[model samples]
Target: MGAAAAAAGADPPPSEAAATPAREDQQHYVAAATGGVSGESCDAAAPPAGGGGADDAVEPVVIDASAVAGGAGEEEQGECGFCLFMKGGGCKDEFVAWEKCVEEAEAAGPSVDVVELCQDATAALRKCMDAHAAYYEPILRAERAMAADLESFQTEEAASHSAASALASEEGQR
Candidate 1:
């Protein structure tokens, strides 16, 4: 039988002649017939395939420093002090002053710069907030800590993703 029939373990097709190749060309013919890389490199512990392992499971990492730094009952502040000020937690009058000034500036003109037009109000609010620093400092610190933790988590996740991509690309090249 022909080499194709031998490799397939079946009779040759009717159109092709049944002729055996010389023994020297048997290895080359078999190698060509079965096209793939083969080696002893697979003896090591194989990496987890297709995310079936617990290590490959995806879970969100939540970092809430507000509960640790600030009082347990206090609300979480995504930004530093704006949420507290807007919610009338402290320095309500100063915040209101600044807000009214900003509104007036907006009402005056669409292009009015609230920062420039309401500089005095903003300064007054800042001074008031500074005077009451002891009340909100812990909350601010907690917010800053949370921000740092989030940034750190994001950076680490990005690094791990890039590493995984590099590994995948290397395997693809092989």
Candidate 2:
């Protein structure tokens, strides 16, 4: 009968239970979500519903408006007048006149004293024209080429528009 009862999965006797350890060894596995630690397996004794971990309380990043404005102000001041004119923001006509003067100055290729002037300007301009003569020369040449091409394109566009108008008038007469 005892064998039959054991085979039938009868409960162990109270004496056998008393002989076993009071606490069994336990294993816990924790997983992270969104690359952050899971809250559920934090500890056996959990914190209050609204409190504890710094991760639970998120503070939004704030930017100072005055700091942002100051940075923008500096950027604006740093931009050359020619760049502003090219971008269609309109700069002082004196800047365009100064560019023309530079072109004339380059044709003369700077007198010894003017070369010295360029060296002096370098302290304020961040580049010495005489030192970077090759670089600036190519840039000026490219600007002139671009201006000529733009003028040619505009002339061609105007001629095409006039021709189209003439053809339309002739067709209407028919």
Candidate lDDT (C-alpha), each = 0.45, 0.32
Q: Local error of candidate 2 at 43, Å?
A: 55
Q: What TM-score number comes out for model 1?
A: 0.32
Highest lDDT, which number? 1
The TM-scores, one per candidate, come to 0.32, 0.26
Worst 10 residues of 1 by lDDT: 42-51
Q: Per-residue lDDT for 3-122 in model 2, tens only?
A: 533422322122211221111100000011112322311111111111122222222112122322354452232232122222121212333333333444555654633334333332
Q: What is candidate 2's local distance difference test score? A: 0.32
**Candidate 1: global Cα-lDDT?**
0.45
**Model 1 clash tally, residue pairs:** 0
Name the runs in model 2 displaced over 4 angstroms. 1-134
Pairs with steric clashes in candidate 2? none
